[model samples]
Target: MMSGPAQKYVYTKLDQIKEGTVVNLYGVVKFFKVPYRSKGTDYCSTVTIMDQSNAKLTCTFFSGNQDTLPKIYSIGDIVRFHRIKITQFNSEFLGISSNGFSALVFEGTAGAPALPRTSSKTYSFTEEDHKIVESLRIWQMGQQTFSNLRLKLSDIKPEQYFNLICHLVGKAVLDKACYLLKVWDGSKCALPAWKVCVEEEALEGDADFLSLHQHLTVDVLVYDNHVEAAKSLKVGSYIVIQNLHAKLHNTCNENQAENSYLEFHLHGGTLYGRGITILPENDIDVQELQKVLTTVNLNEEPICSEDLTSHNRLSQKSPPFNALERCQQLSVTVLPTRQEWLTTPLSTVVKMKPPQKYRVRVRLRIFQPQHLYQSVKLHCTKCSSLQAVPDEERLDNILQGNYTNCPDTDAQNAYWYQSVKWKRNQENRTVTIHFMKKHDMLQIPQESLIMVEGGTFKEFCKLSRKFNSIIPVTCNQANLELDLSAPFLVQGNIWHYGCRNCSSLKSIEALSSLTLEGSWNATEIAKALGIKPLTYVFVMNLTLEDETGSLNAYLWRRAAEQFFQISASEIFMVNNLQEQLNVIMTTLCPPGKSIGEYPWMDCCIKSYHSCDGREEQNLYEIFDTLIS
Candidate 1:
């Protein structure tokens, strides 16, 4: 340690930064812009750094070459710079990289390897630098600044260029100039995301999976240079889309302008370091994303377990929402945000413009779907359709079809299925079984789904036990027509239905040429049958009141589940869970007490445009809050 005027310490901390002086500093990057091509034929990067003091310093660096600009991997990385000139700008100190500047970056996770992710090979890293980095990492681990840097899909607004950490679910080539990468972060966007139209065959991922996640998926159009890189990304790859431009979609292609709906684009060029970086499977960020995906089952088929054991296990693996503690609270405090100035009063939020996020402290006045069971509804992400769960009597009626008589047995695919004849009302009807090639005399329900044609409701109950799934179909002219009244497929004694408005039923012959990419995949089966499966979600409205005002906002999507700390689909399977929910609700809004006596919560509410044609209205939604 070189102290006592022999160069006392090697690096300057953020608090020691002064104006009109050239100094070397080591700090944690709170925020940064990907290196972008500037007007002067140089690449520039804007960054905000802080030390243990939490004093932020704004820095700008320009380089004739893109490689010289800081290659900041993320928002929380530690950076060391040599020879930066600091000057006062607009009553604040600004640092600009002067001549003979050198930079090195390191991961900000404490106890991790002290490795530099820099473009320069000749930069020096002494024992002192290592000590500073490890210390900074330890400091950063305790700060909420890292989480603040991550913007959720629910929080994104139009015309903002931001970085997104998400997983790819689907991809398609729009043309030679453009490619589409459909991704999600397990949160629903505020507005309806723009959908790109193309032949389903052109898609590189499961069509059913894409349709199932339409509510969560955002289509990012990669253009020019970025399209090639996007094409190489496989479905399910975890990636960081740096400097992703979010704008409204319109025929005029006006950049940074609002339109009817929003879309994301990676515009052509290396500007803004606008490219995708694939993260390893074992990456911490990827693991976080996977946890969200697993809980929601958006990437795969929903479990049909009879008990809540699976969902209970899921909760144990995740960060507990502490719903029990929250329900008992008499008062709730609003969580602090990095940009505290953005917090708006409820009275002001209603009058504000669309496409903005606000934080507010408010109390729960009341909530509805007063009949909690009614809140459990099936939603189609693909078509934005919401419907009630079909009753057993109604579903059974739909499954029972008119008796048909056909004498001919279509033994078309003897290689895959066996043809059976059923005598209905004294007439012989041909029932073609599409997946019983050479199994048991009576195939068990553990096998892949069996497609049956000209089958009835009574037939389903008998055959349901024979196979894992059963899809009843009818031949119309030359095309296969599935009865839209019933489920497109059924599995594990759980009835799953398709969205009537979204599904475009395909021919049974389509599966003749089908090749299974993986195991007995449910998503692929839905795609083969042109079925868009429905997702079960909880939806409710909460009337929140602050000192200023009260407004009606919905507790919807994943947030509702997060708030309850329970799965919507599994809530019904477990009797005690419903009692728990009732207890939580009653705690928030007591029956005997007046509205004034109700408890309060400091919530982060989002303001967005209503999709339903209340054109003059701006909608408010409660997001990211769990009671306990």
Candidate 2:
């Protein structure tokens, strides 16, 4: 001890200590390792100390008269060092030569009796010390200089020494004498360390430490001093790692290479020049990095199983509103009338004045009933293609809890079907509708008046289901009555026919109306109709007449069935033609009903001029009908 009263020792903080500078330091013993043989006969031991400023210095004690230094000093014991030589290795500033001439004095222990102490230093922690630790600023990865590279998992390279900050996901897995820690920073990785023996018994006994279940990717591997520091931490704790070794394993197989990931291992041996360092989650840099990580993860789409499970659990806790509630909440606003909607081009609707709501009413001709009625289909959960149910019935069953115990299948597999419908005169314009719910599906019917309540024009153009509602309206309330005297109505005798193509007939600028003067024969009407695609039902062609002239019109599957009071298949399958005709005549023009009293059939005339070499008269065809 070179400490006489005249030549007193000069004390210095670890940060200010310089190589070869002999100084005295007073601090708590942070950690210490048992003395071990170095080369031959020479024994060495290491101890770390942190001053009031939180600056750390590791001291290595070599063979000396005070060979029991490690056994005499304990963690958290306030101690004073005399004439310690400071040194630097691998850019790490530390103190060395805590042997010969350097004296260690344990403070407040000269006359005190021994007392019971916890096996782990964590139990000796005070709230004040915890607050101080939390307030300390952590060194950021970016702040690391060229000699000490700090890197993210994605930027890690093979055979490099780097520092990283990450979350401890699970308990460290013990492999032989080494510990494997699973860590993640959004990106996952593993960290392995050897020769770490701090708090081993306590860590092994902790239930949480033993049952760590989260699998994290290794971002960096820390060993020696750093691993010792980490072993005291619990799962889900954030930590700062220093001097980690990144190692890559070579594989010859391409598949193995594709499946391979980076592994971090802490170098315990002195070959790497120095060991690692660790900072607790309270470090300022760690907290700042954690904030940044939280912001980034908030923006990223969660693709992890944990995220999915959380989302599913949240959704299960709060189910969506039922169909009745949705319908009751819908509100209506003033919209374009039926005639204006029909005449105004879709382009005009798109270019309407600002602040204009996107809802309209129009009379649409129903050419195919299957387009609207059969659009929605329910798929089975077990085998989507094996079974299907209609939208209406499926929704009813769902509401009635009939599907509560669905076997080996997910009930969410049932979904509404989607299809498109074309306007009567404007065949080029189409509207797509999805039967997402029973209310939406039931609200729309073939050839019915509808009031689109609310939506944006862009959404309307896309026919998004986000719209408020598309409710069926009565023809009288919609003011959709047709003017029979309009000259645009196609006029001709029932028997007379032209050879015009159906395409040309669709070009006529008119709203054609037809009145059934008398009962029609079912067999005759069925024979004149055409079969709709996908459905085997027959459509009916009827010559609707008024005093001026008779016009050709066709009834689609649903309308034809309604007019004939029976399904098309039933009418076609009848063995007696007279009986089928009788059924159709009574239904088409019921007893005691005049031509004017019967429902008026509104239609659009579609025709094509003959293009064949032979001269031919233009034929007019009514492709679709709207019954009012």
Candidate 3:
């Protein structure tokens, strides 16, 4: 018979019971068998029971005084065992013998509370209970314990007994009979988290497997019967796992040298006594762990595989070479004439192999030459040391148009240059010309008759020839004649100046419609238009169409402000600016009109020579007062 207090029978939950501990627990009998002789030595009987926590425990009793326990405890009867020896068999269970001082009492009388038998009862905890659970000391990675210890992914060592917490960032990849979960936690190394390989049976029978599939809140992929308690969990649910075996896996790549990471398994070893326990998210330990995780900066963590590979590549030693030598090794092609190269579209330039050179006649028309040049210190590429160059002397030479006297030595190299942006082919183009041994600056005012040789490297196009590579060549602007007698009507979608050639005209009056392409943020719009910082500008692309042809026009801030009757700053403040711009475009260019008919508006056509020295034209329609 039970005495002392009724609560004394509430020992630790079956999952929390440690081996060698004398426990007094109350559990409802799930299964029971009459006493029978094992090897004809002593009578034995087996019974499985479950507590309010839903933890199952199997009780084995041997003959003597305890022989009547199996007969007294029937299925669905709540029984109390006092001082039973808690041991681990397939999992944690209890062992009792008639000779032992253990006692059993039935708690199914009218005085006891009626417990549910059809389903597992969830054990509720009070604040005091939560405090007690939190205060319990659990084994950590570096500790030696009777049971396996919990470890962080970084602390896991090869052939060690450990478990960890990780977020499942990828789908499980099945390899043969095991499912591998890719996990990661914000740690030092960029290596993938310990690979958690779960057996097929463990995954299929897990009740939480269905919940995990339905609501992917929990990042950990659990594989054991313990997951039955986590069926209510969802993705992002913080959990603590215990008792897993860790083994180191090598990539077997010679280049990867000694690189290795850990892999965790749930089965195959007695060291992991109870297989694995996936704690509920609300568990006190898991809540504490969640607090620790909140401080980790997962965004900056190096979890990208590509970044890891790149880091490995950079760690290796490499050689250095001169810029000219590097250029010589690339695939360089020199076209015969500028006309052929000019016909090559910008898209083609983007796809072509780098270090390509072209010989073309380019007119030099600097937009703001004063802002183009700046004094900058040069450095020796090999030693990474600054090279000494008198800035005043260099400026004097640049002004005098005698830029060829700069000295160049093995130890020191002087590279004084200016970046000039200018209008070419009615499009903006920029080039940086080094004033090394070239007097090219003198031709700036002359609309240079000299041949221009340049190269394209990476994203930079039309890189001017360095001082040492500049050569004098006799070339003239190709004579281009236009046939404008018969009016040249419409062609396929708006003709790109670089793609199609049109007859040069001073002005044209056309009935047209305008359609807004789109609007972008001020900063992004500025970047796309190559507008300098601090320059107040709002820009958008508009498609102007007529029965004859169409053109994609650039509407700068000044022109857009006049046409829209609002300041650029005010236009940016409109919440639905795109829709507003479309409305304006529709008013200017009414849709569904006859192919070539609309209210006639006079448009001034401007022409400029392209890189090939052939004229390209653009149309500008400004609302200016008509001169009487």
Candidate 1 at residue 376, lDDT?
A: 81
Ranking, TM-score, top scorer first: 1, 2, 3
User: CA lDDT of each candidate?
Assistant: 0.69, 0.37, 0.34
TM-scores, all candidates, are: 0.41, 0.27, 0.26
Count backbone overlaps in model 1.
4
Model 3 has an lDDT value of 0.34
lDDT of 1 by residue, 493-542 (tens): 44567788888877765554443322234466667778898877888998
Name the lDDT value of residue 452 in candidate 2: 21
- Looking at candidate 2, the ten consecutive residues that score lowest on lDDT are 487-496
Each model's backbone clash number: 4, 15, 8
In candidate 3, which residue ranges exceed 4 Å CA deviation?
1-148, 167-176, 185-234, 237-243, 253-259, 267-271, 302-306, 310-628
Model 2, range 17-119, lDDT digits (tens) per residue? Answer: 7664778776555555534445345666677777656578888877743234433222344445656777554356667654443433332222232221212
lDDT of 2: 0.37
The top-ranked prediction according to lDDT is: 1
Candidate 3 residue pairs that clash: 216-235, 217-234, 217-235, 217-236, 218-234, 218-235, 547-595, 547-596
